[model samples]
Target: MKLSKGANAPVPTSLLAVVVSWRSEHAVDAHALLLEGSGTVRSDRDLVFYNAPRHVSQAVTLDQEPAPRTARLSVSLPRTEADVDRIVVAGSVENGTFGDITGLTLTVHAVDGAVATFEIEDADAVRALMFGEFYRRDGRWRFRAVGQGWASGLAGLVTEFGVQVDDPADPARTTHPTDPFRLHRSARTSPSQEVRSARSATGAQPDPAPPGLRDRHDLAPVRHFPHGSFASDPPRRSAQSAREDGATGLTSDDVVVQRFSSSDDDADGRTGQEAAHNRSDASASVRPRTDLLDRAETAATLGSYRPVDLTRHTSETAPAAPPPPPNPDLADWHSDPEAPERLRWWDGTEWTSATCQHHPPSNRHCARCGHPLRRKLLGGLAPCQRCELEIEEYLTHWHTQAWRVLTTHGPRGPVWAALWASLRYQRIDADAGRRALRAVALSYVERLVTFTFADGEVQHAELELFEQAVTELALGGPLIEDLRRRMHRGRTLSRLRAGDLPVVRTPGLHLDPEEKVHVDLPATHVRQLARGPKLTEGRLIGSNKKLRFVGAGAGTEMPWSRIISVHAEQETVVIAATSSRGGGTFAVADPDYVAAALEGALRVAKRLVLTPGQRDTRSIPQEVKAEVWQRDGGKCVECGDGHYLEFDHVIPLSRGGATSATNLQILCRSCNRAKGARI
Candidate 1:
């Protein structure tokens, strides 16, 4: 059988079996009497063994001569590690179910020879059985039954007998008595009395009585015949008066008897008898002439108890009493130092219960009322369970943004920014902040398009791809709508950024806005010069200023920030295009230093240059001028007057003279296209 979690070790031969076909007051009395008389009863009622086929062992012989033909098996609740009892069976047998013996009866016998039989039909019915072995110890009886497991058995048995399990511990019990006639009908037939008599005749006259019951004459007081034995011509008026004579012996009639042994005075000779009489008289004179019952009544009346001399008694609080034993179930987890506190309970196999020495929280009282709340209720957070859930959600969102920000701006910068934003005093409008976050992302996309490739040439296709990536990264619009109707019920995360955005980490580009000219090379590092201006400064016209470059020379400050461009074709080196603080731009190509510094294949250095097609001033092209004049009407030959049009060239060539209307400039076809195709 599987043991319960934290039970004591196995004790040896402490359990006794008292098989009864019924559970009545008489049966209970008989069981208790047997246990008490034997004086070998275990405190836990491990002695009261169940007779079911499952719990009980098979028949085993106690002695060899004239075999008893009775089962005598002993089992113990383990008291120590070495005390476990192994169950053994003598013959082939199947285990018994609880249902097999639910309809039993018990008998309870009072000390006064009054028997009260109770049926096994409810928890109340089995209450006596559950407390089956109260031994008469030191003149006072105490309960000696196993308390926990029997409740289940009792409940199940009562269910079989059509009753519910109720709290029998309640003092207010009103259980109906079982039908006496029906109970008698259901009682199992005991071995016939004639057969017992025959067995007694055949076997060694069954040891006349149980042990410690010898001294037959001393069992009770001597009767009336004992009074005549004094050769009494003078009849005694009272038993006490007869006892006063020297020859008349005292009996239970004169003595207040008890379960505990009490001493008595016996008459020996005339001298001894006189002395005994003298002693009795002196004892009576020392106290009062009151009956023992009167003393008991007086003690009760005075609300006094017999002074308990507890020196000889074993106290429940003695030092030798074992510490609450460990429970066996948590043995494995208790061995680990890092085991959770709640998981650390008493494990019988190991000491795992940790002392929680941490100071408790401050929220000691309930918010709704002033009553003191349990520590666990307020130990973690207000609305503790719900608060934990909220924290988890908050952490999820924080981590999601953390990964993205770290990848883009690196750990230190992004982490500091996040910390600052979180701690700042300014009010954060979450909705508008989210919109501005979109603009920030788009600005980075625009900046990345300005980067030149390794060949020092920028591709419009790359720019288009960058734009597509930005569009793809945007919150889903049409695609999510299509997916909603086709694949899912509806789009839950409509605001979620798209995952299709490509991660492009082009080298030789200023990936971060704050820092500049970050080149991972060996010796000759090229960074924007700190003493120079940024590329954003400076007019289109050139002044006398020389371009700043990141070179090893005596400069006021290091020009590491003045990295305007880079060149890696045939050489892994960076070129400075602009500098911080309005410094000029310059290229970096120290062959010995650059070659020694640069590692890896010099595929091509990416450059950052102005877009060649973009100009500071705007002007109309020749095609746009032609199209405008044609769309507007031809002008008059005299004034070259045309509605919102300029003079245009015609087929009349200036090389060969041919006076045609197209050759003349008439503004708005008014001057025969004046000043157009003229010689």
Candidate 2:
């Protein structure tokens, strides 16, 4: 049979099963409370079933099944050993209000096949509901459909029942009773005493206290007794009463009860009354003197009081005083004054239930911008609302730029500028920042050169392959060389000394008298030419007697007299000479003009060679020569001697070796002569 709200039914058998079911539309959780005689739970153990499940032997077992969204509790009255006098079944939505969910039902089954069902039709604004309770009554188990709810969910219910939740912020934290319920239970009056008190308050003669409860202070006084009891009999007269009853001497039944009276008490009462009257008369005499003194003082200060004109008075009410000004502190939530570590929510006029306990005030700032956080935005490190918005905007811009760069030739300058600015505010280590930059750069390179699946997504292996390709490219290109120079500039002096390089006072070059910069182009360190080298301030320079490179960290000069050959290849000018240091190569912004200037200064006979695939043994590019020279540090790589240094190709040209910096090596004249071309 279907049970209505507040309906009660008896449990006719020793064993019972209660099942609660709900639709999947709500993510509802189930809980069961084992209450004592009082409606509240006495301890955490009394809460039998929750997120953490437990079984109280074969007597009471709680189980939850997810397949059909149901929770079951089985109770065996015979084996139940705990002092649990009542069981309350409840359900709560995990993360939503119950007003949004529907189709909630609960059912109970007995061993004799008797069944009771309850349907919950409405639960507006409720987050948790107590569906029903089973209590022991009159030696029989009875079920009552309560259908009550709380908007504060399970946590509030736990607190209401005297359990102290350790951490309100963490719902899963342990709970325990604030104080034993037995202590409070001892102070309450018994049912019979309550009944007597009710009768006495209604003007009815109350029943006498039972003999067993007579000494208990919490019980009412004895008023009426049953007939034939000792309290109903008259008292026997003593010998003293007989002596005082001389005038009324008679048999015990005829003896009139002599009312006891005290002559000393009557005299004392009359004296107390006279003393009270005399004290009142003295107080009245002192009051007039006090009034005369007050009048004298008032007349001496401001003369006599003015007479009132009551006849001409008008009936008008004064305007109410203006309301007090609003308090600015109430506009924002702050930590509770009594509990400094816990936050308290203040809603303008009053405090609310909302509160938060996070990190101490010292650490409450934005992790990205270091701005003070008035409220928690996300994670442990609180971020102010404005900083949170800025962080989101920055991340979005970064992602958009990353996507664009990976797809096509995108503007990298702006991206780099943004990165530099972000470093000032973002709390990231130097290595992490560099890694992020490299990753973005590699991602772009990967999309530009690698093939993807049909859906345009690259696999892990494919991504690894692309990363390797980009890393290899970074080893020699302008990009890698620039990065290396930057890394060198940022390194400490210990690193430079460890490399066995001279610790120069200034890492920049000083220009010579006659040398002038013709064209300046920003250039990266060529591996074979410069190690930890700074940017060359002037890329291409001409002098009356030589060509010079005024670099920020180191300078190289090629005297016109020592120039054996000069070759122009694309945007590079290569020179081979007999100077103490092997000749250097350079990249110029205006390659053609630099080539012409070099030729005119050196008085070269042949026109500058500009075409590709020209095997000119006379000269190697200045960049290639500098790269080879710097790689060997102006010494022969084979012998480590600083004499007659020359640039030689590791792989001979006839063997299809490209005249690139990686293939070129520094050698002494003797070693070059020893290692002839294989052809």
Candidate 3:
């Protein structure tokens, strides 16, 4: 479809080719800037032009070969950095103004036949034109036909976006005619050779590299500027350039173009066939693209097809497709014979004791997750509308409290009911707690669901409760689907755990029927202070009874009650068993998770909570220390460093990990404090 200046169109694909075609001998070079939401380039590496032909992430690149005179930029939107807001497609003239050219059009081509073109009508004596921008809107990508230009040229344009380009006007720097000019000039520019320093916009020294990128002094010099810290480049003609650019954004990406035509039959009363033949080609200049084949023989051999005509000669009209059935998880008021004064709460599937009066107000926010209560079933929500609580905060605080409540009292039982009642949300009823209890209910239900799916199965009673919660909370299909996704992953993990036992070649491995499997992961035993070949490949399995590894010709078993210390060093799990043989360092999948499972299982096995060796405050619980010792085999579980030992929680206690043996582990001083908050 054709677009006017300031009008926009949706780019329908992640991969596209943006071609700027103009009628002129003047050299016009295409350039793109990866801008942050603050409307400035993140770094000089974000500038992709002839000087920097490829973006650091390869999200945008100037095509090495272009068709005749057109300039093309290949875009891979998915490869773009998460913080990158948009790609500004601009062009600079090294020789003449854009006014000297004709047919100035920017076209974007998708893999499919979707094409969007914007034509520049009035000519202006500008050195650069912002052809358009491929930007993100509500999570989807779109293009806005800016057709805005600046009189300050390419060097001035680069300076506007937080870059200190070697200015041509300074006379100290020589000009690089990167263009259609490259085809005729002696010197060709390479991104690495023509590189400018991509420092902070404030001209501060570049910040230290990200933690993951640090300590590798041999890596390439890609830079990042902190968000909200990029102060505008001073002495740049940004203000004056903005004044010359008159482009204004249009309403939306989904533009509709209507076609109105006057046929011969409708206008001059001629036949339909005559109108088509007469209008087939008004002039010889319009010709069929017969480049692919010349043979009419192929056309004769092709299959014949006809369009379906529903309005033509049918005995009866075809029934219109019935609209989809309303959502099963619907909430509406239903009449009750017993209470004529009030309608009963029909939570989609059944009559609920909750009255319409008990329903939360529209503005109520969840006290638990801090997510807003859905105002109505299947309705839209405010974008990014979240309360002050971060997800980590919820996990650490409210979620922990809820889990503790469940651990003390079984789900769907009387104690569980009492805990729900004691939620004490005081919103519309009094303080800021109206309808907040429902989020608590959701949280508790989530825990129950997780526990139930641990065995790879869900009871019918559990499904009913889940459905009731959905209807009561006015949840939509997407949220329901997400819950199902959680269920599926849990079930998959459970089944994999169950499969781990049968593969053990060591026939001595056995489990009582009551012993529930908690952890099952591939492991390789690491022998400390060994002569050679430290690893003994095996499968590590844990249950409420014991921790054991069974491999080719080797086997090791440690009863949970006999374990002393459990440690995680890097990617390995070490268990110090008091009377167990074959106990050593085991490199396993997610050592922390294995350590957690072992501690929890040990607590269940021993049923005791106290550390005899701990002579300190309650910060390191006595019960947790005892279990960690039993699970880790009475030594520093990490690195076999028996000295300078410390007790660590596999999953921090604040994040809902149990305080008993399950969460505790042993670590040496260096291993425990290696990663600060990241650990």
Candidate 2 Cα outliers beyond 4 Å, as residue runs: 112-114, 168-679
**Candidate topping lDDT:** 3
Q: Give the Cα error of residue 414 in candidate 1, in Å.
A: 21
C-alpha lDDT score of every prediction, in listed order: 0.26, 0.46, 0.50
lDDT score for residue 281 of model 1: 24
lDDT of 2 by residue, 1-679 (tens): 7889999887754777777777756676666776666666544444555433553234566675544667777767655433457777777776787677667788887876647898887766788788888787744578899888888877676556644444535544422111100011112654345436656777856434322222334333222111111222333333223223321111101100000011111222211001100111212111111111122122212211211111212235332322222442222335555455544434222343322332343576543333465743664644455433433433444444434433332322222222332322222233443444465554444222212211112223334344444553342456445433333332322122122122122225455664444323443224253566433444555544456665666767766677775555555666777874536666666544455455544542233322322223434564555455556665678898654455667887657877778887766657876886742
Question: After TM-score superposition, what is the CA distance of residue 585 in candidate 3 from its true location, in Å?
Answer: 51
Q: Work out the TM-score per prediction.
A: 0.12, 0.25, 0.29
Better of 1 and 2 by TM-score: 2
The better-scoring model by lDDT among 2 and 3 is 3
> lDDT at 509 for candidate 1?
33
Please give the range of 10 consecutive residues that has the lowest summed lDDT in model 1.
178-187
lDDT of 1 by residue, 1-679 (tens): 1112222221122333322233222212111111212232111111112212221111211211211222222222221111112221111112232223344432222334313232334333232233233232222222222312233333332232222234546565333211100011111332123224545777833222111111323232222212112222333333344334323322111111110111122221111111111122212212211122222222212211111111212356433522333433211212224423222223222232221111123476432112343444646534433222322333334334533442243222212233223211111223333343454344333223212111112234334344444543353455334322322211111101111111223355323353322122223332355886423221111101121222344222222233333223233233434534333232234332332222111111222112323311122243443343344433334454322223333443325533333442324323432443454
Score candidate 2 by TM-score against the native: 0.25
Which digits, one per residue and each the tens of the lDDT, describe model 3 over residues 1-679? 8888888777764788899888878777898988878888754557778745776567899986788789999999867765679889999886789989888888999898547898887758899888889888755688998877789887667667655564324544432211000111113432211111324333644333321212323232322211011123322222123222311110000000000011101222221111111111112111121210111112111201111111212236544322222432333333443444333333222343322112232455543223355555577554212222222222333334444443343333222322222222101111222144345545444444533432223334345556555554444555456675655544443333222222223345567766666676689987755577567787898876778788879887777777876656678877878764735788987875576556546655676432322211214443455456557764567687754455666665435555456666666658777742243
What is the TM-score (0 to 1) of candidate 3?
0.29
The count of backbone overlaps in candidate 3 is 23
